[model samples]
Target: MTTQGQRDPQPAGRRPDGRSERARRATRTLPAKALGWCVVVAVVAGGGWVVSRPHPGDWIPGLGPSSADATKTPPVVGNPLPPTDTDPEALTADRYFPAQRTIEMGGYKGKRNGARQGQDCAETLRARDVDPLHDTGCQGYVTVSFSGIDHPALLSSVTVLRFADDASAAKAAQALRAQENAAAALAFILPDTTAAPAPTAGAQQPRVEAVGHYLTVTASRLTETHSASPTAGASSPGVTAGASTAGQSAEQQIEAATRAVSYAAGAQFIWT
Candidate 1:
């Protein structure tokens, strides 16, 4: 029994008077809800941290340039050399000849063995045990003749055997040079047998030079001579006498012409 002003005491773990069952249940769930909120916040923060870090080969939006992009080299431009092809027309005669001269042979022929109707240049190459031009992986064959300036009666001929690659051209050039040297040596003993010029006391020998896939043979029969100055006033009755402008000797002139032609040939056929 309790008096009107005194409160009645309940059992342990029970709320005071006037507390509802619903209020007690809500208070019990409040702590659990707070713990769930804390767990959700931790998970969200960890996920955000992982997303903010850098990745391989990735560029951040509106940030500094990427390492991969900065290290790359810029592209080059344009073809620096002339084109190569298997067509005989690919070897332009004007590219190697001087401006004053014209093509005397192989100007219209479009094959490796176009020197003559029956005598193919490729067959001639084969007779010497050199694989025919086409069979040796060459692009084509071209030969031309030009009138010499030093000696009007002499003509300079160039035989260009064009290959598809440098190694083939180099091998062919080496073999051809050896053949030419051997023929030259034999010409002294058997002058009428070999077509090569005999190595006299002062005679210009043939030259072989490689330019890219093209191997060139510079050959001519022009006689070389040194310059000679005449008497100051040695004027002839019919001929007008003046100072000679032929600065270089005949041999020097021939060599200069060969070098010029070789350089032109190289420049005309180099691959980019």
Candidate 2:
């Protein structure tokens, strides 16, 4: 059992390859260290990838990258269009006139109408100590009339007025007015009054009447006058006389009147 040359095989507790047990253990630890370094490298690479990724709201400033990355330019605001008529009284009269009649009388009903109505309504609301822009319970009035003939037709109008009740309502009204104004302005700038027939010998002109309260606007026809007798036997008309295109159905006229009042009210608060 005791061999001096072999040193008793290193006492069986030591490694047989001429290294001590501690030395052999140290050699095995090297692999774990190498594995740890590999893990560290992998983690660094993953972090780099994450850092390089783009954020959802990221955008390039001025270089004009992809459209998605392009910077948003503010909308350009232009000057308001010039008034159609130089007559201050005529301009002021439009506020109290019917939209249909005004349109017929060489007045614009699109942008100009919207702008004028909006301004006038704003002034009225301000005079009443009401904040039209933010008040939803405000009320206003409008008036329309028809005249200039042996028979006269009038339409009085009223409506509830409010600022856009919500964001969606505001946006919708804004878009509608923008589109309507653009189309109306184009048509107004180059009017085609030639196509309109001249007033008949006894034909009537249209008119408007309006009144506003704190919470409601009431409109009514001033007076409707019809001639008693026709020329010969011109087939005595029924209840709906002289109401062709000029006089829309009662319901339609009411709807138009209501819209006009509401539009005027909305115009008051929209400009700011």
Candidate 3:
């Protein structure tokens, strides 16, 4: 199959055309390159592992929270709340009673006798009145007096005791009502007389009401020295349900007015 002059068709690593197959190295190059590549991969993987883990903050002087600090409970996150006994200026008299010299409420025009606002509970009310809420978070006290513009003889008063919350006021109100048929009322702050006259109430009892965190004690009476008398004249519809004022005496008229004033006082506390 061979001719003497023509060499064998292929040499050890040559193609049939007599070109050397590929240049060969004295050492095994592929294995050495694979070993170098494996070494490089190992180094990169080791470096990445070291960088991925978190280092203790103690490793640096002032970098982040220490391990001990991180484990500790964080301080409360929201704003601090005020104490229950702190005064809320919202309960002041000028805002609640009337801004003007005179005000109309519940179809009755009234002239403000005066308002005693932000007075200490001890100062405005007697000891017995204040005792119910002394330890119960009574933070505000106000008393306002109003005389009828048309009927000067008629007078009305609203005494509001503001507590921290509805529960406190309700508790205090219950305590107050438990003692007497009507909550005791503060003396009128007369426009002219610093020396208040004696309680003018005859048959008309004060109204005690609690709305939210406020307690209002309302009363009405004749400004003049008068007591319950027999009806002087005849007939007209009265404000009280099923009760006709047609033959009502002066005392009975004032008692009806007390109901109106108490209702008006309740409205004042709706928003405040």
lDDT pick, better of 2 and 3: 3
Residue 108's lDDT within candidate 3 is 55
Candidate number of the best lDDT: 3
> What is the Cα root-mean-square deviation between model 2 and the actual structure?
19.4
lDDT of 2 by residue, 211-264 (tens): 221122323222223444221112233443333334355345434443454355
Arrange candidates by lDDT, descending. Answer: 3, 1, 2
Ranking by TM-score: 3, 1, 2
TM-score, candidate number 2: 0.23
lDDT of 1 by residue, 67-180 (tens): 775453122111112344443443443333323233222111111101211113352242444342434565544454443332332334455666667899898777655654
Cα lDDT tens digits, model 3, 54-105, are 4333334335446674553122111112224444445555455543435565
Looking at model 1, the pairs that clash are 113-121, 225-250
For candidate 3, the lDDT comes to 0.59
TM-score winner between candidates 1 and 3: 3
What RMSD value applies to candidate 1? Answer: 21.6
Per-residue lDDT of 93 in model 2: 22
Lowest lDDT 10-mer window, candidate 3? 73-82
Q: What TM-score fits each model?
A: 0.41, 0.23, 0.53
Off by over 4 Å in 1: 1-89, 92-120, 123-135, 149-151, 180-202, 223-247
lDDT at 243 for candidate 2? 36
